[model samples]
Target: MHKSYVGRRRKNPARIEMQEGNETPTRDQIESVVSLYNGGELDAAHAATTELIEKFPAASILHNIRGAVNARKGNHEGAAKDFQNAIDTNPAFPDAYNNLGVALKKLGRQQEAIENYRRAVSIKPDYAEAYFNMANALRDLGRQEDAVSNYKQTLRIAPKHNGARNNLGVLLNKLQRYEEAVSQFSAVLLANPNFADAYNNLGLALKNIGREEEALASFAKATEVKPDYAEAHYNKGSYLFDLGRRQEAEASYAEALRLKPDFAEAFRSLGAVKRYEKDDPQIPYIKSLLDRNDISDNDRMHLNYALGKVSEDLGQHREAFTHYQNANFLRKKFLNYTPDLERRLFRMVRESFEDVERIKNIYRAPAEPFRKTPIFVVGMPRSGTSLTEHILASHSQIYGAGELTTFGMAVNSVWSGGEVTAEQLQTIREKYLADMNRRDVAEPFITDKMHLNYRWIGFICMALPGAKIVHIKRRSIASCWSIFKYYFSDFGNGYAYDLDDLGEYYASYMDLMKFWEERFPGAIYNFSYESLTENQEEETRKLLDYLGLDLEQSCIDFHETKRAVATISSMQVRRKLYKGSSEEWRKYENFLKPLIARLGED
Candidate 1:
């Protein structure tokens, strides 16, 4: 009889655990109620528990069981009340407090939930479940470091706690600690080989660190383990899209949407891959989704941007402008931007590098050992940086390390009181190069087309004297119009959202470039976008000669280059040069009066 009871207790862990140190209810009674609740018979369990509580009104365990049933039924308010009743009846009951926290968390009362969890752990110091619950609440509250600590504590107490381990991995990924995140996810997979979500998360961590092949293998493994995983397919599509495999990306996104019909993000990504030439059928289907009242704000933003792209492709200039305007307006609501903040930064940069004497004095310091000369393509956004990069990357000796932020980040890290030392310069240079090498760049002349590096020209000259700076210039109207029409993911491009802000920012950029040119004469090579388009051969030869490289016909035939381009101009760069992009802005000249007024062109 004793052996049979122990076997039954093994199958009903929750009931046996709850009955410990409690005498009101026999083990059989507790098992009966808990079994009904655990088996998905919520209504029947609730009725039985209500009768049990009436018979044993002061039974704290029965109240906790009823609260668990209420929570499962999504009656969080009722659950909180029942859990509080249990706690009040037996103030030392740790399970009652823990269950109450779960109910409060479901109600979005995270602070209250955290307090209850603390009470649970205080009553029972080794309560691994309460620690895990508290960690989740902390993560939701954006206290990531505290969440990480609590999750670690949870795992220490309960070594096989899979939930804590997986969540810790996710929080680490958000914090950009990809290596640690990979380890956590790997441990999860080792414990349970069929854990599909862990495999997907491990792939994301691997991708963040530039291990593309390994990441893809992990994503493939997830799909193999869970054949119907829509999110894994969507992630695969996103990775392919980033690598410029548009056809494969389209197929992956389509499969994701087929598996989950209401997947709005997959639909938006599919539209991006379509490239929306004249009269694409997907345009109308995307527009039809806007009529659905349940569409999310993010989905609406993507749809508006897609509509703008399709309209632009079809040569509906006015309609395209309207959609672009709506999209920017919607996105701007979520960003913290002010024109004055940018203007002030520009002012500070100019003043910092104002004196040529001070710059020369810094140059007089000992120079670092000369390394390979890197070509920096610096200019305003949409000023033909991508085109110039594509042209230069066609050279066998040059590798295009697209739009590196390493120099900019290094400058931000070391800038102090307008003074820099030779040692500091060398440190910055070595750090920047180390970052580039990690990206697998080994060419003698790599092009860092980080357009905003225009602001860091003085630092670049001091740190890397061998580096060649190419300044790409575009006409003001065309540049501003292009910026306004596009959606930039970088928060630093906040000025692009508004016409007046864009104009002012462009003026600041021009002013700073003039300062750099004056301070470092003959250091910058100027290239005009219009000139490049009009005289591809003449300009390409001049650019090649400037870089001291013999002319390669491949530079002129850049369209045939197979390298991946991860820019807004990715599509344009894949085709031969067209002449109309410069003139297209004139069609919307009337609506761009604010921009024209700000540029002092009127």
Candidate 2:
């Protein structure tokens, strides 16, 4: 949130130093005001600049100096007017325009600020500060790609611009370009080793790329550098929570809340790990936040979700439903979910593989066996995909590779209108296996528990014939209810926020799985979650047999297996199996009539 070129120590102050015109004020008179401004005597600088401006009314430097003083003093409105006056005196003044942009941006006029920044950069193309300011404005206006271009331009002009680099890294992370983000952050930290934000951003990017241990170290470094960084603490807590370190996660969250008491996301994350009792103090605090009008919809959404979690734990089913309903209602505003578009995509997927014989013909086994094989645990969200992966990964020779996007990236690379050529199929196979081979795991089998990989079963069969696909099944009501009640960090699960959308999406998923089953009978191992809970030994034996592996005692002792699980079910998978989860939805059955009706046939 640093302003454009304010506190930077640079030689040759082009923006502040006035030219010696024939009729302008003397150099000594100008220096008197500029010296006060530069010396941090804002009151003296403002008073002296205003007095001199009256004598030399055409002096743009006097106005610019006054604007800089006002900006430093936090009077953006006055600073903007002063910068405007400077621009009027000298219309080609890029500095004044840039300064005006900063002032206007502080006043919440991002579009106008961007316009001023554009004008400044146009007047003087080498104005790196203007470009940096424009990039910040573009990000505020939600023009992320444009912001990135401007940020790159700023760095190109001023390679030592750590602020621009740090912001660019953050924006890249938001765009999910994690590796590029890591590079930017790393470069920033190389020059400025004490840059806390860079360390924090690097941690985020590393986490996204499955470098959890490195990410944790980066987060720790960020906190060590900046002790009061609440967001860093919150992020560390989230990573810990995903790793099933509930106590440590809770402690981190507590530190974050201590630093920033109104941190709604931290509260929501704390609620995720905390099992609430009747008199939990956090309950009233979260409820109090809901009554405050100043809170944002995003904050309100998190607060409501947190309240919902605590209420549900306390058996206040109806109250929890109300909070969840409100939370989802707020959440839906930020998501773009079109049922028809989803339906069309599903239809195309079905049509692409409609020629079952052609699809089967294209399927080819590798010339040599892969030293490492993948076990894809695919299914709907909250349908025990994580649990299945945890169980399978408990084996001595299997490792859990959580929710990898390598296959999806390969699919998107060469997939043309849902069709794939034989060469393209090979390319997909090579790309996917190349990524897998690059992984550091020594295990012969790795479990990829990216639940939505259910969508690409046909491609998986063709490209990775050696891969085992396990389709974990749960009762429809239980699964949909589980999805709707909780929040998914991934935006792809947009359908979960609405009951009707959830039902329709589930129905399509079931239908697609049926089509796959019809085409590739006996290919997918359909594991029943309920059955696994009821008869753990028999069902697990069947699962292991499908993968051609001998039953291990560790599989039965899955709860005791130690590994990092980064799913919502991270905590759940660490405990012993229990039945009756499917029946929990019955408590909210009356309120879920719409969902039930939509899922009637399922």
Candidate 3:
């Protein structure tokens, strides 16, 4: 949400000349008009500038000032015209070009806006504001890497530009460069101590890096600095919820909703933490927001999900299905998603791993030296991966590194397609182990619960022979329904939005797992999620026995473990194991025929 700083006000305007025999305006005349504009009297400034422009039609400074006034008055068309006039009179005016770009951006002409910003920066390479403006436009256009470059350029020209630094950090966070994002946000706080958004963003990056305490403190500080910051409150709630502080998290979400009643995210988060009664007041309040014409599709989407949860809890299955349908439809439209992208990746992975003996031969070499063995928990999302990881992490000998993307990154960097070379396997192993070793945990093992890593089972087996891989299986219908009902922050789960896509994706995943299991027999440990839930102690003993570890009491009492869980199952895992979760989907069976058909009654 970086704003474009149009340009600084012109202080000295005595250099301009009038036509022959015409009197030039005094300094007082120009300053008076600027004073009106600076004082927020946009109408008076516009009127005064018009009078002065009539007298000195070639006065570039007057046109620029009037453009600023027009922009303040929400007359971007007039502002654009005035800025163009200023550029016409003084062709080398960087400020006029930059200001015109801002107007063009407001008018939804991003390409034209970028052209004006380019002209401004070309005239004066040190124009940090113009560079920052160009970055904003580039970001809006989804050219994130280009935006990062320009933001860096702005910071280079103006080191103290908090906006550019903060925006750069936000992009970095989105890119999953959390450590780098933390550095940027920390630097922003040093420069602007009172920056609440920076603190909120800092909290996000810190949380991503597993600095839970510091992250919570940063979020609290953001709310302390700006009590009216609804977004910060929402973020604080999310963090608190991740830490299993349900009561505090509820209070924070309530505060956020109180501050900004239309905050749809807050409503959804509040819904997540609550077990609604039939007569809950939040139902009517959330429904009222839907009736507002000003509500955006994004807001409406979240609200629908919130309502869906409430309906489901109230035993209104049909109503819940309707809400989920609306939410998924809007989400699909917003994402403009197609399942082909993921299906193609799945196909490529299968093709690459078809030569199983080659993979084994290439990866048979000794793995990187590690004090702690790496355990990978791979499965479809919402399929008990988080629960399994939490259970394992509760063991004294194991630590849970929730959903690390290091393995995928390493594989993507070194292995393209077809047979992976021994050298590439070594590279991936080193990269992944290097990242893991940085955590420096004292435990004998650590779990990586990136569920989508099911595609990389073959790679994991080859690269890290010491690593233990656990594949959790759940009922396909239960998994798909759970996935469809929840909003995944990661866009990789785009297939979850459509029933056919989800079913097809799940089929591919199952096929890939089967191939991996066949290619590398005895390398993978397969377990059923339902069996684990139904027979907790017996299944726990078997799982631990496979990993050559004793089943500790903590593993059985995983619910009592005091660690942060950052998934939709966070709350569920905090409670003792329960059955009937697989049966909850049956309530909406009539509405889920499409999904049922795709999954074949599984």
- Note each model's CA RMSD in angstroms: 8.1, 5.9, 5.2
- Indicate the worst ten consecutive residues by lDDT in candidate 3: 1-10
- Of 2 and 3, the candidate ahead on lDDT is 2
For residues 399-457, could you state the per-residue lDDT of candidate 3 as single tens digits?
Answer: 99898878887898887776778888889888887888777588989999988788888
lDDT per residue as tens, model 1, 485-596: 8877656788888787788888888888888888889999999999989889999999999999988999999988877565767667777887778887888888898898
For all candidates in order, the CA lDDT equals: 0.80, 0.85, 0.84
Candidate 3: residue pairs that collide:
none
Model 3 vs. true fold: TM: 0.83
Q: What TM-score would you give candidate 1 relative to the actual structure?
A: 0.72
Q: What TM-score, over all chains together, does every model reach? A: 0.72, 0.77, 0.83
Which portions of model 3 miss their true places by more than 4 Å?
1-125, 130-153, 172-180, 209-213, 356-366, 413-427
lDDT of 1: 0.80
Best by TM-score: 3
Worst 10 residues of 2 by lDDT: 1-10
Candidate 1: 10-residue stretch with minimal lDDT: 1-10
Better of 1 and 3 by lDDT: 3
lDDT by residue for model 2 over 495-526, one digit each (tens)? 88888878889999999999999877878999
